[model samples]
Target: MERDFDTTKDVVTNEVKAKKSAQAKADAQLWVVASGKGGVGKTFVTTSLGLTLSKLGHSVVIVDLDLSGANVHTSLGANPSHMNIRHYFEGAKSLQELVIPTTYPRLSYVQGFWDSWTPTDFSYNQIQNLIPELKKLRADYVLVDLGAGALEAHLNLFKTADEKILVTSPEPTSIEKTYRFIEAYMCHSLKENAAPDAFGNMITTLRDHRQRTLSKPFSFKSYLKEQTGISYTFFEALSQKPVRLVVNSCRSQANAELGHSIKSVCHKYYDLGIDFTASINYDNAVWQSVKSRTPALVAQPFTPLAGQFLNSCKHLIDPEELRAVV
Candidate 1:
């Protein structure tokens, strides 16, 4: 059975290779969009961002890996279909076979499961395999919607991407959850990449600092520098993959600036610098587009929501752009 599976994968690889254009050979950049909790507009952001990119004449694919909430298709006005990731896992189709085009030109997506058991048990090994297949797609960008939470499985996908965009609202609960998610992600990355001794020391120091100064926030960077004084490689590696943050549902200038505040907290406490890429205002057009089952960029291209998505994509595509809290 293992041999048969390997043979099948090889065949799919060759078939995909044959179908690729010169542009596809360059490989698509994987942009993973996730949230610390649900109802933070993660899927909406994914669809809108992809739509904006497509308008720029870049081919984009949005994969609804958020199996539990799998509504990327609905948000993009694509009807339900059996062409989903579950079929790929069942060996019934290749990832390439599952690509379904959206109504918007240059945009496409893979439907996720609905009214069925979510692939919550999707293991790390499976993600490693899945990413290579995603890269084989003939697109300039592949936006993966990872739904929510800080589960180890989710963090693995989040950290493995070429770019990571974390979506959150300005609500207090959302802000708290986002921080917890980042902490979980940091711990996960440390465990995976740090030496056993170094990992143990840092973790212990973090816990001790929290206990001693319950009122004061713990900064892993300070402890690592003062005590461990031995290894800076892990943090240096983390610095290279700074997560991009997007604050959604902002109703005021203060709400929009929440992203900047979160960015400051992350840099100070976690020693991680995250880009405050966008702050989407609370606009009726956004939810209206959701009700119409069309992306805001497509349904109301002239709306402020569309403009915000455009800015988000610009910052994502070109990190050198001066970021401002919109």
Candidate 2:
């Protein structure tokens, strides 16, 4: 009777595990990680998050979409494969064929081209075509590392993601650039979805006005009221995409406060709710790991930075407040 009871318990445990595996696959998420500028640890964050998610038993693919400077392969201590995004663009390979397994189990990579042969003009139609194909990839989380700056292609990729994450450092310039990037994203989204005449004219007018008055701050709410016939609530609801911010290389408590300050200012000025999800501490181990081409989580799993990465991933999985507010 005791032997039979043990067998039943093992069977139940196996069944539960199988159910969770199936559910995780069914609920796959695509996350796009972008930054306003380079040297803000965007790739590090992307690789670490991918490793963390995979370690948590979720299959992950870290795609390098930084067309100008693709280096995600170096972050994972792997050499670039012949099959990359360039091949996909050249019609020599499918998106699935571009995937190259990394050293880490359950973690794959789709390398981008780093040479001069990289495609210069990625049309919107191409991006639209790529999105559905990317969704078909076999991974629980597809993390795309976008190029620095707010280029049209980068913005489109960010918009396509299920979760858009912006990485910024504690520096003032980085913060300012991040705000501008968010503004550009919101404007692009508005132009795409909102009525062409009204929204487009409003954006054009606002650009000219801002250029004319550099000293004055532009208020999105005020512009909406004065320029468009659209209701503020309806417009806000239409533009209500939740963006997650991760403050990288934070050293002091003041840095965390600065992140919150940026969030408050964005809400007040842009009427956009920004979720400041994680503050990664400035750790020497991160640099060491980068230098060695190993992920920080693998190099220093017990460090505070690793703990923060795990916490950030968890928050991203189910940001309750962000969901409720959005």
Candidate 3:
């Protein structure tokens, strides 16, 4: 694998930096891949998709944003001790300087910090600094691999993506956690955008409703629609932010339909329409490739898993097929 960081390209002029930043933001697409819980092939999907895009002649950069877990480099067959995001976090290097070329043509990645010393939670200033740098990365597609769960940092990072893909397994626990993630993200977005006084009362009502029955399905849409104080732009933003769902490790047709079921639930209760992009079946080649520290698409290019990754990339790259909430 080509794990070299190009340090020869230095001493860039201010005008060149400004022009490059503008060009990158104008051309590149940022895709954030996340999961409700770990153990669901989120990083695998990210690396596979990045390889697929690269094979199609697009410059792809896979960023391991899952700082605490930080294993994208391992999956891509790169040394973990090589220059990573820790250098950027510790002020030893800029974010752009951390980008390292992968073995595949047109593919590169920014490794995450796996050391315990790296902060698990970021402050507001850190997020502000990191996001712009991420947007400025020069690539056709920038794939960010987020850690599992609905942590504030994850949701904040997720909200800024040009494309958001929520990966999940078909198991009952995974499906439930996926729903909880969507709910948490919805509430997080509202907390950030909605009027504080109005949202405060809304939260109290939500808490009261939760106390009625553990089986009661949560519905934030109906309650929010009833409120007259909140601005329409809040609802518009919620309606417009489309999430693409990918169900991984499927064993049967029923397992494949889980993505659709989750999408239906989100539209019903959360007022968000999520695309059921692709369902990848259980394949031993996937694990075998990972065990060898290589992406499945690159190691087993002729396998069924590679075909599925190609299909998923096609669905993801097309902008018109994305469904917005009604």
| Candidate 1 runs further than 4 Å off | 1-22, 211-218, 226-231, 319-326
- Candidate 2's error at 56, in angstroms? 0.9
Which has the greatest lDDT? 1
lDDT of each: 0.82, 0.81, 0.79
Cα lDDT over the full model 3: 0.79
Q: Which candidate do you rate higher for TM-score, 1 or 2?
A: 1
Flag clash pairs in model 2: none
lDDT of 2 by residue, 180-299 (tens): 898888887766646768876777766776577535766777777776543455345534557889999998999866778888988776767888888889988877876887877888
Q: Which residue pairs clash in candidate 3?
A: none
* lDDT per residue (tens digit) for residues 27-113 in model 3: 468899999999999998898888888877678899998865888888898887668887887799997898999877889999887
Between candidates 2 and 3, the TM-score winner: 3
Local accuracy of candidate 1 as per-residue lDDT tens digits, 277-308: 89998878778877887667776778888888
Model 2, CA-based lDDT: 0.81
| All-Cα superposition RMSD per candidate | 9.7, 5.5, 9.3
Better of 2 and 3 by lDDT: 2
- For TM-score, the strongest prediction is 1
TM-score of each: 0.85, 0.84, 0.84
Residue pairs clashing in model 1 are none
